[model samples]
Every structure is written in structure tokens, then in C-alpha cells.
Target: MTAEPILTISGLNVDYGTGANGVRALRDIDLTLHRGEVLGLAGESGSGKSTLAYAVTRLLSPPGVITGGDVHYHRPGGGEPVDILSLTPDELRAFRWQELSIVFQGAMNSLNPVHTVHSQLTDVLTAHRPGMRAAERTARAEELLTLVGISADRLAAYPHQLSGGMRQRVMIAMALALEPEIVIMDEPTTALDVVMQRQILRKLVELRERLSFSVVFITHDISLLIEFSDRIAIMYGGRIVEQAGAAEIYRDPRHPYSDGLLHSFPALHGPRRELTGIPGSPPHLSAMPTGCAFHPRCGKAFEPCAERVPALAPPDAGQDREVACWLHH
Candidate 1:
């Protein structure tokens, strides 16, 4: 059964500056994250994957600005949607970790080098749950460590004391400290080895199942998403080119960019295949190509691809999927 929508992003647009000098980073992006499911967002380095995460969390700084659109969080237990964009400073602070939390890319480095793990974990609780006593906070901190498969003994240790995976798990522990309904993880396993990455993702999935919180896992690793995500959304040039069930995307990708991304990863179990990296680099937002931004590199591009933008819509197939390409239209 399809889960209820937990977060709805409508007509979302982002730009770097104001007026003509501004460069568009995101354009009319629409997405829905369902309750208790892992939604994977994947693309190349500059495809605006991180930007989308930061924008959704309102963590974008300086020149980054939300030009338009609304991000609505559908409160659990069937409450009215709360417009995140409309939140005031105090409301925004209270809304952040208590409702939506993010485990940023390279999150391990985000830990404070000087503070003990116990202190860091408790700080979140102290800030959010002011009524809790100091002893209660310490006990909860230990429990959080144990929940992430780390020993409570490490709570007193500094950030440098733990291994890479342990540190990453510590970050996960912090994000879950508040038991938020949605957790946005931006490439949570960037430098970890394959085995470690798989282990972390597996543990994350296990925790999600038990905790019942939705996840927006961002990564450039298509294969990892194929293994772990319930649904996959492929981004190209700051827009989602295709989105569908993970298996459907792997079996039959509709967009040319999606196909390219899927093929970029090496196959492990299938017959040996040569890896073909996506041709050409992504277009610069300042001088974006007319029409489809990917048309410059898309092998399937025709005259229309260069002249008109393709709206994301259902393809000829009846499957529950959406694609943005003139070829499908």
C-alpha cells in the first residue's frame, strides 16, 4: 500500500542572486516524500542534489535564495499541512530538529572536535527538551549510542576517538535524538569503504523500520540506492529527470539522463559490461543551454529537445512513474 505523504514540495524554485545577475539553481521542482519510506535522490556532483536538501531544510545561506514555491510538512496523525517557508525564526528553530532533521554529507566531520560525544548528544536534547534534568539527558544520550550499535562507553570519548563508521553512526544518533518524522541524509557515507557503507545503510534501514521515520537519502551511488531505496529520483541539471519505484527504475528507465546514470555504475551479478560514464559535463547555470539543459549531452536529443523544455509527466507506460523528456511525451 502507498503511504501517506509526509512532505510536499510544490513549484520549488531556487536562485543564487537577484534579477538578471541571478542564476537559476532549481526550477519548478515538485516532489512528495511519503511516510516511513526511504526516497533516494541521485545525480552527478553538480546536479543540485545537496542544494535541494539544504533548501528543503532552509539551511541555504548567503547568495542562495528560494525564488519561489512552498514546502509543506504534513503533520502526522492527519493534521493540517504546515508551510515551512512561512515559519518565523523562533518557530523555525522549534520546527527544525523536533520535526525534520538532516544528516549532512561528510557528517562525520561536522562533529565538534572538542566536545565529548555525550555532551554533543545531550546538547540537542537540552535545547529542545528544556524540562529534562541533566541526569536524564545523560541517560538518554547513552541510550541513543546503544540504539545506533555503538557502546555507551564511547559517549565520553572525543570525536577523534571513534573510527570513521562509529563517528558516522554518532552523527546518525544525533539526528535521531529528537525522533524527527523526516531525516534528510546527504551522502551520509561519502568516504567509507564499500563494506562499511553497506553496513551503515543496512543499519539505517533497520532503524527506519523500527522508528517509522521517512528518509531522504541523497547520493551519487546509483547501485546503493538500487539496493536500499523504496523509490528513486534521478536529478539532472537541478531537476528531477525521472522518479519511480527502485526496481522499475533499474529495469526500465524512461529518461535518457536516468539511463546514463544507471549505466555509469558497474554491474556485480550480471554479465560483465563495460562502464560508460555519462558523456560531457553538466551545464553551468549562468549559461544554461536553451530548452533541455541535458540536450547538449543527451544522445536521444532531437530538434524539439533544443527548442522546448519538457515537463515531468507520466510516460506511455501505465506504471506509477514520472519522466521529463520530449521522447516520452
Candidate 2:
């Protein structure tokens, strides 16, 4: 059974500056996150994957700002329904790290080099679940460590002392300490080798089943996304061009960019299709092309694509699928 959404974001347009200095990072992006679901946002480098993640968590800082958007979140057990975009600094301070959690790309650096794992774990527990005593906190942290398949004894070790995979596990453990309903993981396994990546993803799958929190998983690996995610949204430049179920996406990609992505990957059981990468680099946000943002790199482009931006809606799948492309418009 499909779970109801825990978070919903609609018509989210995040821009950097004002007047001529403006840089648009996201263009009318819409997405949803439900309990026990992994929604993968897949794109190339600088495709606003991380930007969307940070924006959802209200972690965007400085020159990189959210000009307009509505990020609505439904915390578990009916505590509060929050519009993440419309919060004061004080409210935001209370919301972050506790209500919403994110595991950033380079977690090795994000982990404190100076503090031991125990101290670090205690910090989060103290911040969110203050009701827990010293002994209780220690016990809780141990349980988290075991959940990530690591020995709780290593809580005495410093972040610098652990391997890349171990550090990544620690980050996951800390993020789950609060038992937040949603966790946004930004390429959490990018630094690990193939073996470690599989192991970590397996653990994540297991934990999601055990704990039942929603996840917005951002990554460049389409293959991995197909394996792990329930659905996927493919981003190009600053806009999401295509989004659908993972299996359907791989089987029949609608947008030109998504088609290109399918062509780029080598399918495990099939006659080898000719591999082809999308030709041009992504456009600069400040100087995006007219109409559809992906037209320049889209091989199936025509005049209408260059003249008007396509709306995102149910594609020709006769199902709940949407793609912002002239063909599917």
C-alpha cells in the first residue's frame, strides 16, 4: 500500500538575487515525500539536487537564497504542520536538525574531527530529546550504533579514527537519533566504493523498513536510484523535466533528458543499446535559454520547445506521471 505524504512541496521557485543580478536555482519544482518512501532526485553535477535538499531542510545560507516556494511538512503524530519557507529565524532554529534531518554529500568532513562519537551523539540527543538522562542517552546512542550495523563500543573513537563507510554510518545514526519523520540524504554514498555503497544502501533499506521515515534521496547515479527509490525526478538546469515510478522511468523515459539518461546506462539484461551522453553542459542560471530550459541539449527539440516552457502534468502514460517537455506537454 502507498503511504500518505509526510511532506509536500509545490511551485517552489528559489532564486539567488534580485533585478539583473538574479540567479534562479529552482523553477517551479514540485515534489512529495511519504512515510516509507524514497523519492530520488537524479541529475548531473550542479543540477540543483543539493539545492532542493537544503531548501526543504531550510538550510540554505547567504547569497544562495529561496526567493519563493512553499515547503509544507507534516510531522508524525500531528505535532505541527509547517510551511518550511515561511518561518522566522527562531522557529527555523527549532525546526532544523530535530524535526528535519539531512545527511550531506561529504559526511566525512561534516563529522566533527575533534569530538568523539559519544560526545557527538549526545549533542543531538541533548538538543532534541532532553527528557533522556545521561544513562538513557548513552543507551539510545548505542542502539543507534547497532542499528547502523556498527559496534557501540566505537562511540569512544573520534571521527578521524573511522573508515569512510564507518563515518557515513555514524552520520546516518546521528540523523536518526531524533527519529525525525523525514531525512534528506544528499549523495550519502558518493565517497564510498561499490561494495561499501551496496552495504550502506542495504542498511538504509532495512532501517527505513524498521523505522518508517520518508526520505528524499539525491544522487547522480540513475542505476542506483532505480534499484532503491520508489519514484524519481530528473532535473535539468534548474527545472525538473521528468518524474515517475522508478521501473516505469527506466522502461519508458518520456523527456529528452530522461531518455538520454537511460541511453547512458548499461542495462544488466538486454541487447546492449548504444551509449550516448547528453551533449551540452547545463546552462548557467543567470543566462538560461528561452522557453524550455533543456531545449539546447534536447535532440528532439523543435520551435514550440524554444518558444514556450512546457507545463508539468500527467504524461501520456495514462497514469500518475508528469514530465515538462513539449512531447508530453
Candidate 3:
């Protein structure tokens, strides 16, 4: 990964309602995505992983609002960074598919059931590249299908005619139609089987390498993130608990939550061992814990963990690692 940052998010805050009754979904989030690198976001359901993605893309709907944050996109080469939150509606529309695109969680739900695959793929090109001829659009659509390993003949197939994996590939094709600089994928492989998931992930890595675009890959699977991402950020109760290189996170996770997540998954190539999943359900948004959200469930929680929230900072135990836990702080 390059040292230059392509996307930077600072002091991000989000809420699900308005006024005094609002429940904060994300709190003081700060993250950076370097150019041509994949940054993986891992957390359990309702941890605000999807919320952060939607907020960054400005796709958050009603009842879900970005209360505070600054999202800046630094274009290629030297130029003024674009403030994403400040963009007008028209500018944001143009910016969406051209600069950034997203593949939502479910492919079947994302694709239009009535529309043909060819039309859906070409629609993106036609909307963004208005000057292109019909033949060119058709050619581009076929190329996109080919890029995603789908047969060109499938272009005529409707959503229901294709398999789940193919539908997901079509969604990926649409996301890449404009060749955006950044792609946010929210559990793109959640519906697929293990074999299909690996195939899709491998294809995505190949595409990222060839296209040189940055990616924000969000999922609950920490193991998958460790294998495919350049860096990993662990979130708990909407707050980032740890951020570090994939290898570093896998080998030595300083945060208790991170350690728990690592232990939750089974080892593929190691001696047989019993799985020790984290105890207790994730805290509800309305009744979040006093200080550290994970303290109630943390095996290593101490007095300080319950008294004050720990800032995500580099720990003395390692370099280039940040953990938000009193034990490390």
C-alpha cells in the first residue's frame, strides 16, 4: 500500500434519530484508506460497519443521519481534496458512480428483477458516459461481464434466471462499470457458500491489483479480512477498537475485543482446538455500556475499562498498531 491517502474520515458521528432521544450509531470514527489498498472493516451485526460505509458514500436514508464528520477524497496526483459532505446534490450524483461505488449486502435485492443484465450494466455507462454510442455501450457491458467471469450470453438473462453467485457478479460488474477510484463492498459474499465466497474474493483481489483502485471491504468475517486485506480495523459498539496490518492483527491483537474475535474463528491449519466464542450478545444501541462498550463482555476488563473510554492509540507493545482498550492504553 502507498503512503498517500485516497480517503480520510475524521471525527465521524452518526445517529438513528433526532433531538434528545437520538441513539448514536457511530462515535468519533477516524480512519484512512490509502490509494490502491484494501482496508477491511470487521465487526458483528449492528456494530455500525454498514453505517460507516453508507455515511462515507452519502447513501444513508431517513432516520439515519450523519450528525458530524468530515470525509475527504484526495484525487489522483496533486490536487485539492474534495469534501464529500459539502458536495451539492447534483455534484454528489455525478460523484457517486464516477469516483466511488458500492456493492450492497444482498445481490438479489440490489439487482432489478425485471431488467436484463445487459441493460443494467449498460445503464451505468450510458448515465455516466453520455457521449458513448449504443454499440460502445453494448461492447462495454459485454466487457464488464467478461471481467467478472460471466458469459456474454448471460447478458440477456433476467435476475431470476441467473444463480446467486452470478447475480453478485453482475452487481460487481455494475460497481466497476465506471471504474471508480474507491469501491465499498458491504458483505458482498455473505449469501454465497464458502467455495463461492473464496472465488469471488480471489477475483476481487485480482481486479484490485489490475485496476489500482482503493477498497473498503466490510464484513463480520475477520479471518477473510486477514487473508485478503492490507490492513484491518475492528469495530465494537460503533467504535473502532483496533487498527493494524493484517498480519499484525492476526499474530498479536492488543485489544480484548480483537483477541476475542480472532479466537471466535476456527483455525484452518492448526491442531484441533475447541472454539471459545465471545460471551453475551452485543450491547443494544439504546443501552450502550458506560465507558468501554466491550468491557461487560471482555475477559481482561479492569477498573479503568469501566471508568473511562480509551482512545485508539499506538500501544507500547508494538509499532504501527492502535488499540482502544485500557490494558493497552
**Candidate 1 segments whose C-alpha is farther than 4 A from its true place:** none
| Cα RMSD for candidates in order | 1.0, 1.6, 1.0
Position 133, candidate 3: lDDT:
99
Please identify model 2 stretches exceeding 4 Å from their true place: 1-3, 77-80
Estimate, for each residue in 140-251, the C-alpha lDDT of model 3 and write its tens digit: 9999999999999999999999988889989998999999999999999999999999999999999999899899999999999999999999999999999999999999
lDDT of 1 by residue, 25-108 (tens): 998889999999899999999888999999999999879999899999999888789999999989999999999999989998
Under the 3 Å rule for N, CA and C atoms, how many clashes does model 1 have?
0
What are the per-model numbers of colliding residue pairs?
0, 0, 0
Name model 3 segments beyond 4 Å from true: none
**Candidate 3 lDDT:** 0.93
lDDT of 2 by residue, 173-289 (tens): 988998877889999999899999999999999999898888889999898999989999999888888899999898899988988887787877878778898898889887889
Give each model a TM-score. 0.98, 0.95, 0.98
Q: What's the lDDT for all of these models?
A: 0.93, 0.87, 0.93
The global Cα lDDT (0 to 1) of model 2 is 0.87
Clashing residue pairs found in predicted model 3: none
Give me candidate 3's TM-score against the actual structure. Answer: 0.98
